[model samples]
Target: MPTGTILVADDDAAIRTVLNQALSRAGYTVRLTSNATTLWRWVSSGDGDLVITDVVMPDENIFDVLPRIRKMRPDLPVVVMSAQNTFMTAIRASEKGAYEYLPKPFDLKELTTIVGRAMSEPKGRPASPAEETNEHIPLVGRSPAMQEIYRVLARLMQTDLTVMISGESGTGKELVAKALHDYGKRRNGPFVAINMAAIPRDLIEAELFGHEKGAFTGAQARSSGRFEQADGGTLFLDEIGDMPMEAQTRLLRVLQQGEYTTVGGRTPIKTDVRIIAATNKDLSHLIQQGLFREDLFYRLNVVPIRLPALRERLEDIGDLVRHFFMLAEQEGLPSKQIDQAALERLRRHRWPGNVRELENLIRRLAALYPQDVITTSLIDQELSQPAPSSLNGEDASQNLGDSVERYLNGYFDNFGEALPPPGLYHRILREVEYPLISAALAATRGNQIRAAELLGVNRNTLRKKVKDLDIQVIRSSR
Candidate 1:
């Protein structure tokens, strides 16, 4: 059999030489590119059948290279490599449809095996799990992305640092936080959760700092704040981005001084809490916008962990589906096996919501779409509607999105593997328009003025979208 050709791309000269020798010794023709520019040129020029690329190549956003590579050869296999190996980069590769993701320090045998198998196929095959109709969330696949997430979790088990998990709303930020806490030394402590956005602004300080018997009105009795409640435990601050500036400042003090006092109490109380704050917001962006404090950002994000969005880490779908399968069974649901077509559809989806979304979908499938094999039709019907929040604390509107994004970017230096879909402007408009229109209509009870304040959008703009999306508001007799 003729040796298949391998294209290796990275900015490092030494890596390229080593890879060339390694691949050459393993019985393959090796070609090289120093950066994405040269790499793109070679791929565009129809250079080789199998491409291996470093994500952070000079002069290129490899994240953007996926579509172009597919455009050139839709079936040509390509493997992405990265040193940073962040959730965003892995997820980006998945979104852009890479054949496989290989994080740095990879074993030689694995690379050879992947390339040999890819070249043999004569068409690209994404490194998705082996197809089965089983409805279990198994955390499947050996993809580097999944491995890296596991690696991070393992490392976090050793540290007591305040972790900040970031990802999209459905990307499983809470799970990451839980995994760290459970695997870490604080496994036995109470895991107290407080969603900053869910609570009213005025009460947040009181909730976090605790209040004296008569600190403020309605202070009927003394109550412990999350800090005190979570003494010697893990305090998960979900949607921490929505924390008021005043609260943020105080939290920063607690983090810095390792203590806090009740709202009205002058005596300082020491805290032995491990914080694992999560958000989807761009805290840096918020900082630039003067909404999020820089000091607090650094304090909360001592150790950042990024969770992969469902679409960003599509390779893990099989494992996730399998995991969800066992999940449904445990919850007393009938068998919810997903067939090949359904799995493919799950693979193709944009999954605006991440793993949490997928988990919810799986549970719903198990509960509602019982046995006889889950199909693409089922998944399509599910995706057609707006995804609801899991556990139903608060609907993951823009605020939830903000927190997930913050946690994701905090750990994963480079962002998602997949670029946002085409028509981002339209998608954003719809995102803004639906809520704005719905809120206005709801607040007004179909009246225009009341709806506008609830949405903070001018009635005229709301009217324009109502016209554009054909959203009808029923006339109220009020």
Candidate 2:
């Protein structure tokens, strides 16, 4: 006897035959149809043990008939298959009470496994109504890599699971976080994002958990932190690996107990926020180096999602370039079009800064080049120029003092009213001293007297400073 009867619907005869053969070989009776009308007739009459339907049918859309099927047969399970594999499609399938969603060209073995699981599992509750929105697509790309990400994100939207996104800088970690929050059940709630790397080490806790009026010397008034602001929503902790060890401990406690206290308050406040943390660093390495807490790493890495770099998904470069071009035109930049050769050139690049770097290059091309068409030579010319962060030889164009001042300005901007860590002068000087002495030594070919003269310091003082900074000396030929 057959294990169960499976209802299969699709407009394509080839797909129907394939699924029919696969299901029949697996010891199940399969009923095949090409239109939604026939599929719904069988479903309404409770003729099949399970329903497998395509998103688009010749007679009607499966999504349009899905709610009626659910209302008529709440116990029946439906697996949705789609050729239009997008984030929105996956989300809609899930929202319409799909047992599972399979993108086109899926493996036969995986389909069988999913079918088995769906048949054995108990029936689920009817899906909640989907939220309405008219925002632009947050993520773009139809490569296999992006399709897999969309599937995972779709499954995660209904729950409050803590997601840990790991990727290189500029690979759109925060964008993924925002997509999750924007499409999730908490869409009505606010999304609070804080970059641990941007904030000072000592102030990280206060920034996350708020502070009492008299929390510390500089606390003139009570303040609410990110957790309070994100209550009933998502709290996105970007650059989570940069969080100090002390703050990590407190964050772990909050994750464990679902509550937190102000910096100087004794009363614990309950939290109803979903935690989504992201990092560009290797937390495992940090844990091994004693810079991060292992317990905290485990707490944050509940559902880890690693985003692929641009080079890994080079097939999507053309789409991304077009998207960026559209954005640039919307922002009042000159309209520009890239030729095939120019796009191929982009695909060949390593894209060390990933998507953000590509967007900036497109913007630069639109602004600098007056021509409507962007060619290979123009792309090559723009790419050959040194990146903003690239440091040239010893005599780099940017002055050391000016660079330090700019870094301090950014650091101070991270904290609005709070002061930076104590011993600012010593800390800043110590940071600058090592590099200054090292460069001077390298320039003078490790000669103590000449290096001292170049730095306008005494030879003995240079030796003492080198010893204190642990500089390794290499003497060149005389």
Candidate 3:
């Protein structure tokens, strides 16, 4: 066994000496740097198991230097140290890719443990998700957000740790989980899924753990459950938030012990399946409500991925629509064309149901719209009468002219064969600009200063537009 190598970058000689001795004592090789330039050099071409660098290194600020360093060593786990820690600085550092941020004067034991964990972490290209047997349900989007998701999924593929996916309903949480299993190192193995909420309270355990013949009234012959079926690959538990409390205890024990007997069998059957659980509800809150187990929560949450909602990443809608359309066309449906107007209309609508809803809408358009044009007018009609039962009255339909104008205004609306008249352009632009400005402002927590920076305009300019367009800003937890 080779010892781990740690790169220590700090301006203070005392701190460097202390870390070096501490790491050396813990059976690690220590490489030292006194400035950001040397730190950058080591990071550029050198390989180290871990990096511990001071935020206020001489020659350059860590924040300004990190972007380039990240480009060189993208998977490198970095721990940032700072004597002057502020919430903003801490957030910025973590957001940039620093694995952990520690305040100055950290304890030796803490340093040793954190460094050890970082070194042992899985690194390199994550396994590609399992190739779809049927490409009809492909995940789409080339937006920066989707690209980020791809990067994360790729990294996760390198490790077989349990993963917990959190997203609102209709955000395709299951799709993300499936992607993890498909591209991961376990792709060749079976992938089994079950809904914890869908099963009756008395049956979740039986659904997970196989039952021997005569285990219970209906247990004729032996039965294998999801865990057994996915023993060599992945087992996905959806709606985990709704899992029964008693079943949660059993599941937690199985995760910790890695072996479980069938419902009525005496001998234990070991499984090597990777567990991927998802939920639309907030599990943390459930834990507080005493309906979930803390130990179980921590075990399954070894890796957490937060999926962004469709409304949160509207820029990707254009690509998703096209992907869904391609899928529909492959199914023998006539290909549908969406002009810039229809695309914009889709983007501006608050997608409460997220990408899944968008996919359904696109498929409906492909299947039913009379003409290949798929005009904005058709979209308006569909929006007004859409899955009334499914949406359950969350639909807030805009007036007819405004809806038509919103779609016709965007540049990409040209894709549809029948374009809206030029006269509607100015009004629609104002409508689009007003809502966008309001949304950004709302996302910034009503901070006029931050909102202007995000909108790429002067504060005074944003203020004038807010008044001119009658933008109503709301407070959001941005």
Candidate 4:
């Protein structure tokens, strides 16, 4: 039942023919062109109901014509197709008011569906264009995983929806969040980030919602919170799963009411911050343990984006390596080129620490190595050595004690010339207990009796710990 004229433009006749055939089969009248000028003429003449155009044309770029089309025929939805398939390409398409951006070589069925949806949907004004910038591309990679992420990010750039990004550590969750804020409608607003794990649990509430001079025993001057600072912008809550229950409650209230009160302050302060929360921990597991509020999770997970680990997208390693080298060159490091064999070795190795680990290795190769070309042997040598404990990617040879000691050392080092907030003993115990108990449960196949016996604790105590720590108990018959 698809009706109306579909305007198709592309430099390639084959592509135009294919689109014409597909759109005609979909029961739509199709007019085809090989350049943007014809598409613009059709739109300006009010001849086409929907416009499907390639990014680059022989005569004029579709991007240049898109804004004019939007101004002249705002109701006509324009679907942009491009073979470029870069992060910036998707962004540009969205910015130019394209209803949807389809990376070339896309499925014919998907294209038809998008056209149908666009045609049926109420005609509304597209998002207002944002100011252009050539800031450093924060994201790189063209694997299907990355392409999907780019598409999702492009659609989200104009909206203020809350986003929850989940992935392993070093998967560039913060980079994605930064991209969201930097390209979003609130680009002019401040982007404030607070790590839930880094701050003491007791201070988290005050840190998030500000504190009056007499809020607590500190009796310090009034301090503004991240919410206040990120007003009209974005607030990225990293390690959100580590947020304490009290802080979670306060955060839930803010999300619900769009207003909050400072500690010891009676006046309510309204906020307009787009919350972008990221976590490596399984929040559903935390919710099962009664540690995280389920209501808050739904509020922040309005747009859930799970970033793939570097291991999941090995095809992107070459691009990532080149990007890192370019960054290193910009930093005045010795220029380095990685050989094919070296890149193959990288692809074979398990990237346990994800992209961050790879970036560090690249930096080391660029800075420490004397050779212009990185070789397989050099890669093997570096991969064989134990990752430094400081990088938090220690090798398997490192025992729990050594890892704990290194962590404590770093924790203390972070507070040089100062003392850490109180309740360190309990916090450290909880941190150690979570993994230990989770491991025990896994070994026991989620049998509480067996796990408790293994841990030399009573079954009730083990149950309490499990619930308190928010460790997900996956039951299996092994």
lDDT of residue 429 for candidate 1 = 49
**Alpha-carbon error at 418 in model 2, in Å?**
49
Give per-residue CA lDDT, model 4, range 1-478, as digits (tens): 7899999888899998899888998899999988777778788889988989889899888888888888898899999999887899889888888999988788899999999999999877555584565657889988889989999999999898999999998799989999999988899999998877545567888889999998899957999999999999999998899887888988999999999999999999999999999999899999998989999999999999999999999999999999999997887776889899999999999988799879878976765556789999989977997532321224532665676787678657745776654556765675457667877777777777888898899876986776554444555555
User: How close to the true structure is residue 57 of candidate 2, measured as C-alpha lDDT?
Assistant: 95
For model 3, residues 149-249, the per-residue Cα lDDT tens digits are 65466456647989999888778887888877765678789888786644455777888997989999988899888888998899998888878898898
Clash count per candidate: 38, 0, 12, 0
- The candidate that achieves the highest TM-score relative to the unseen native structure: 4
Worst 10 residues of 3 by lDDT: 386-395
Best by lDDT: 4
Task: Please give, for residues 181-280, the per-residue lDDT of candidate 1 as tens digits.
Answer: 6545677788887766445567889989899999998898998899998887899998777787999899999999999989989999999988999887
- Lowest-lDDT window of 10 residues in candidate 1? 129-138
Ranking by lDDT: 4, 2, 3, 1
What lDDT is reached at residue 324 by model 1?
84
Instruction: Give all TM-scores, in the order shown.
Output: 0.56, 0.80, 0.56, 0.80
Predicted candidate 2 versus true structure: per-residue lDDT over 65-125, tens digit per residue? 8888878887788899998877778888877777788889778899988888878777765
Candidate no. 1 TM-score:
0.56
Supply candidate 1's per-residue lDDT for 382.
69
